[model samples]
Target: MRILLAAALLLTSAPVLAQQSPAKTMTASQDAFLRDYAETRRFMSGRPVNPRITPDEKTVLFLRGQPRAPIQTLFAFDVATGEAKEVLTPEAILKGSEETLTSEEKARRERMRVSARGFTSYQLSEDGERILVPLSGKLYLVERVSGKSTELKTGPGVIDPRFSADGQQVAYVRDNDVFRLEVASNKEHRVTTGGTPAKTHGLAEFVAQEEMSRFSGWWWSPDAKFIAYTESDTGQVEKLSIIDVMHPEKGAEDYSYPRPGKNNAKVRLGITPVTGGKTVWVQWDAEKYPYLATVMWPKKGPLTVLVQNRTQTEEKLLAVDTASGKTKELLTEKDDAWLELEQTFPVWLEDGSGFLWYTERNGGPEVELRNADGSLARSLVKPEAGFRNLARYIEKDRTLYFVGGPNPTESYLWRVKDGGAPEQVRPGTTGEAVEGGSVARSGNLAVISHSSPTSMPRTYVVRGDGSRVGELPSVAVEPGFVPVVEYREVGPLKFHSSLVRPRNAKPGQKLPTIVEVYAGPTVTVVHKSMAAHLLSQWMADQGFLIARFDGRGTPMRGAKWQRAVHLDFSGVTLEDQAAAVQALAAVVPEVDLQRVGIEGWSFGGYMGALAALKRPDVFKAAVAGAPVVDWLDYDTHYTERYLGLPQQHPEAYEKSSLLTYARDTSKPISPLLLIHGTADDNVYFFHTLKLSDALFRAGKYHELLPLSGLTHMVPDPLVTQRQHEWVMNHFKRHLAK
Candidate 1:
């Protein structure tokens, strides 16, 4: 069933290549120029490119694509020999069925189809003998010499497979339980058992995966002798059920989610031996440190676990001796609001006596080298003013790469040594270069660079001294497609929007402007990048002016921009968006303010609902999915960060809630379509339910799309397609007249 869903998402949309220039094609001289450009661009852009250097610094691996096919295959380039060889090919992995399959089988096949455009997680073995690839819930081991691949296991719902250092074992998760597979014997053994329903083992819930940015469940130790994982018990969490009314076979699903100020999932850490035995639970003093953010295994003998308290402001890094189970506090960090958890994996030093740490304590984020005993070795990458967040750290050479925004709307990449003022690397005035990844081992460098308003991704290789070596070919863009019409406007007539305009736009045609918003404190909507969403483009192609802007409360800049919406989240974001729209309407006469529409999911959904009610003069139509109407109904960790506790700030919470303004929406205002999944745990399905009831009692009319068997993150492709189609139809009926 999961495979079918995955296939549906993959096969649902076909790539529509825009027309390219004839000169865009690479010439012999142009190819050489591109090579140099890719190299120079890598250093200048501060992005990870090709020729990925290994920890040992001797070997380098890169991805090479055939110009004829749409797919890209992985290739290893030996810098020493100046030669490149193809390592993995789709032909080698894809086999069995050659004939055109049935519609159902085609759907399944599409789900299984791996795209070169999509990111694939591949890790080389410690010995560099084989590579582990997780494909379609199955682990595949590919030999370097013969390119021979063998499926290790085909378990029910398996992901995040990691190879042991000795390359003798492979560990993965199945049905929320961690398991280890013996390579030679092909035997699977469960390391952790007893997974309760709605609860998870070695993995995070949906909200944590998306909002908190957690993916992998289990972590391999330095010596590969033990594994540490997290367990979440959601039995006490609030349960929301959804019934899929649109499906031919109606089914119901119940999701346990912790909404704001509600019960949360209890989390704990445990360790298991690779050879298979009883797991040991790591005990923690709840009063001192209750939440487990991350656990690091600096050395095999003693495991260092970093735990954050329930308040999230205080963090303690505890060194637990695996032999005696004795724990000692190594370091502690605190903040007024909350300390940002190190979402990425921590890099341990060679000797394991100390490790690298990053903190946003002194106004902005900075890197600090700390000993295992918890004392700070030195402060690295300190800024005199403004906020700087460490993006990546190349520990081998003691260099740190970071993203800094002097202001909230703009961002740039900067680099510095272990302790120094960061030198600006990728300096830009308008759009931001979204740095993907950086691989700097043994002085050879590579970076992936892409900016807003461009679809092509360029790769570059740099030297140890930050000089360009060479550049890879540009990502092929379809030919003949030209963007001419301006879709949306912002600020004033001088400030033209960066939204992609439709090529077939007619003159004097006033298109309906659809605003996509996720007005939240933790995130921002505006980012300068060429990475386009297909759905956003589809709306534009259907003759809608799509525009998105980050309201107050979004991060990335300084405290003022983010804190502006504090204690007034919903109202502040809505007002900013409303003002931006009014300004845009005054400048861009092509946009019909009377036909303006807004749509969003989650926090954005909440904003859309509020905008339609609060600023009926601007937004004529709204589509909200899984919205939070009341702040009191949401979870503690997120809501408390902004509005404080409901008990402490009752007036603030009441004013910010959409439910308070629902009664004042008697006037014939914008038409609204509220969609929600019954099993939504994050925002809770009750938010929509209560809003629907409130509107009905107030004699207000609105459309409701209640789905069953769906969670906060809608999984069904059919439902997603229907949702978008309904939104487009609504805009076409009202805006495109």
Candidate 2:
């Protein structure tokens, strides 16, 4: 039965992914497989992303595609009336015009992995009366009440357009220069003149966007008088060329890419007014701390910015004086490992009396409500060391909402009222055993999305009093198959692990197991949402036991656990995966540890490749997709934060790199399949070529699959589905012993 089920899945799957793009002449079964897989992903993840409730809580603004349509449209959901209506659509706005994106815009979306066509993002005004949507270099402002939109006509190649608090003016960056457009006059005013070929007035550099999550470089003052933006100069940054082999006529595009140990883009902060005035440069020691992590201008405090050193070990929350442009340190946070940067809301209290900051300076990760002058008043939660965060505060109940827990696998929604004890709102949020979903509150209503491994996602509208109003109407299609999976902590380390057996498995049967892992910092293997692990479930349905474990170095556990990979990414991460397999096999007896294999992409890909080379006794066969064979080949921001300066610590760099271990012939070799996209600029397809070269030199024969015109994160739904299916077939071929 197991063999037959695997054969059925492989009928539409490729035994070996063709080097060329998937042909259009696929069989009916293959076409149907791709379509079903794509639809499942599109629907299971839910259509709406970045949902925002208006300040009044009367309506919710979100972006979703129209009824499984390719193009996404802006929508507004009326809470009182319980009606969802489309505000704007791509067809209505484009009006048959060709959609052409500037290179900068394309890079931004690529970093975000945003595939939705039309307005992928929007900025809600402070008053919640307007939203600024930038589509294909053009700006459109939509009124909430009237559902009317008018083109701002800011300028060519406009990006990062934001609205002032009063909604009377808009500050936008166009072609590296800052420009302000007054709503009433419909006139554009240039705010800065110093931007040059290598410098930008208001834009995040590549590192900031890709690693820091600081998407926009501009911020508006609460009084709607001044705008604070970053000045990025990339003259010192190194450049890398990316050429599309498919279109040689277009030639290579050279972009400023700062690799490990290379000079990063010089950054500075400047303040400009809406009415147009001289730019006030914020004074800070840029040489000591080049990375600007976060910028905040809360309603109740001075402009605060968080800056970090190149190694990311230390950070300072500085308060900048608007008049002199000089900064004073509010607090400093230092860690033996790299400091983390998070996007937090309501930096200040309601009256702006004090500020709320989340950091590890207090011995563990927790939120702190400081006094007006930056002195710690008290810790929001007790001295428990676990993952917790400040989401937002409910004014009516005086409750500060947060998400996290001591268990790394699971996180709960908790709230604290006026420094009282913390209350758990959603107890069962861990990916292991899901009961409820994550919650986000706006106004008097909270938007709740719930799901489990065996169920579809359901988003509900809940009142402030904890009563469900109704389900938010979603047009997403349901999945073709339901998932059957279970969670366990089989090791003494209490490893948060999961095992997805074949949905149609017999009562007592042994099965070949494939361990799917990420096992790196800031990435979790277990999530409460069923849709999050859909691919793993699909792999399980194909007659192999799919396993995932949030091993050491992953987030949500505490400072100690997350920092275990401080300088050694190859050791703890791999050992935990191997141990978990043994532990799970001990518990379930039917899990065949001898026939075990490992597979993953990116960091997980690196892990899979390492297991195949270093631990062949454990992982017999591996699928390494877009693996980073060397840490030195990655960007400076992400790599340096972990391994430090490659020049200063050459030995550490050598030990951390997978190429070093590949040369060791005595480690034993296993069957390995290397997969990568030619156009993957992030991991750089060069890593795969180098690894393949190392394997060949070591006299190890391995399979290689190269994808054309594919970035690190392939955006096409059809391509993603087929690519995953092909990988499943590869595992079946080798692991189906």
Candidate 3:
């Protein structure tokens, strides 16, 4: 009777045990790493560390411990005296009866809970006595010493407020027009008011900001005499319509957005006096060159503006005399593909002899000391063991900091004297060194260390002599957080990856796996930072082994790693990711090869589609969001740089495109889900539409999720949540036994 009852129980529970048998338990070391990893995540989210040195160089401000709820208040560590103070308390910002606030006020307060979220533009005064904060689309002056704050202006779309050199007056932009405000008298005057519906007087359009990374459109002269601004006429550019559903009436909003080989906004440099009135347009012969790269005011001289030709192969650093309106070419850089310009203005030496310039003329990216007249003083730092790109320059201390890489996955911090041999500052460290802004006064170097994976960022202070002073107070790991089990332990996964196993995993159990990928060149997933990556963490918690790997073409490694994608955008990167996945599967027996899933957004979406098409056997399911299925469909500047001219490398472009493999996608592929915004300008909705048509013709069954009236980035939180939910659902449906 007992044997018969046991047989009945085994028969009843066989399916449930089989389902639970695949989850593999982590090892002791892995378990410890998981605990530490969890602690690292908690510590990072709770206590953020950033190196902040005073302008006098007498003190370094470091934050310790996490603030409660709103995250506005925390302990600030003063490096000099080793004293900590609580500053910027949440209680100061919160209204009376925080729970009883209006919905709008509550939303605003909640927005402040996330650091660096609410403000569109923020700047500290020269003396750090006051903070110029952009709130509710206007500028406000908040005293650091006293908790008092005053509204600076209430105008039409204000941004980029800058205090004059004397800190007496503030210059900012209002609806593309430049405005100057007196701090004490509260007097405001319109400096340049010619910005009409078609023409912008002192500010650039959306495309310039999104593509060129030019956020602020103006700069103030060191003498506080003139304001240099860019007036972009976007009427000539292509108009893209975006729908606004939040309005009482859902309607289309039209804006000019330039795509590749399309007409771009004609931008011109203009200088205006602080006293107010008209702006003098910086004269440039239209036949010679038209595009402006950057504008800067160096020392008390004329405004220096960097201009590039339409082809983007040649760049000229032209100094425009504000008084005379005469322009002279200070320096010209030419390249085979496209000349790279420094995003920030050139650092001027105190002596005014010249400035530090970064160029890639000698095979690889290097730094050269250019005289005030733009003659090369010397090549400060050149590539030695590997390709080096000057990321930042500390002019006061005569130190040049850069990221050099033997390969794309690994990067190291390197420094060299203004005219000395390059040396690895941090040796044998596998992580990338993120340069904090140069301390203007002390000439001390501040950096944040990051690794490919399994390493969190830690701030450090280094002297100009290549000696480490000490690590600044960093995020403390929480006691209960576990790393190994909660995070992926994939070795040297190309470009770094973090894996997470289920909490209930047992020894030798095989588990289905999912990979979250973003193959964009601009962003790196494996950086050594404490970011709340919700998708991967959520998937791991849901009993699926999840992984994230940054393929080649990701940033922070240096020139070669980024430039390698040139002319072969998706091919080489996809190959590296596939190899990494296979390597991970081989090492981790619990990764069930038959039930693997891959997903990404934008460029990542492009990669996901390619992965499923190229290696159907490896990736069982794929969720691609707003993917650029074809290189021809993407914008010109970005696509042409990486994939070269479509006319030049037709075969390479075709091979890299997922559309080319549509006919060959007859394998027993896992379920594929394609999502896109209907009005996506960056990666057009047409990309998904064309792919869907092709897939249908190929007799493939795939899910298509279209977000109506959405742009390139779906800003609606509900839509974003739904997208994540769809991805999770796809993974659960395919990867689950």
Q: Pick the candidate with the highest lDDT.
A: 2
* TM-score winner, 2 or 3: 2
Cα RMSD of predicted structure 1: 8.9
What are the TM-scores, per candidate, against the unseen true structure?
A: 0.76, 0.92, 0.77
lDDT of 1 by residue, 433-499 (tens): 4544364544345443544444435554455444545554443423222223233436632222345
Model 2, poorest ten-residue lDDT window?
1-10
Tell me the tens digit of each residue's lDDT in model 2 across 1-737.
00001111111112534332332334454456456667545464346656777788777777776544557678788888888888888777789997778878878888887766787889898788888888878988888778788998677888878788788898888778888898988899988877865898888988889898888888988988888989899999888877775667878877888988988999999888767788788988788888988899987788999988999999888899998899998888888788878766328876878877787665567777788788998777654635456557755566677666666555555667876876656444444433333344442567665566666666666675557666666777776665666877879989887777776788668888999878877898875556666666667766788888888898776678888888778888999999999999989877888789999999999999999988899998998989989998889888898888888778768887889988887676777888787777788888998998887787776777766677787656656666676676677767786
Q: In model 3, state the lDDT of residue 246.
A: 35
lDDT of each: 0.62, 0.76, 0.62
Q: Compared with the true structure, what per-residue lDDT tens digits does model 3 show for residues 49-161?
A: 54455555544544344421213233334555555565543334433423122222222222232222233234566776766655445567767567476777546455567
- Candidate 1 lDDT: 0.62
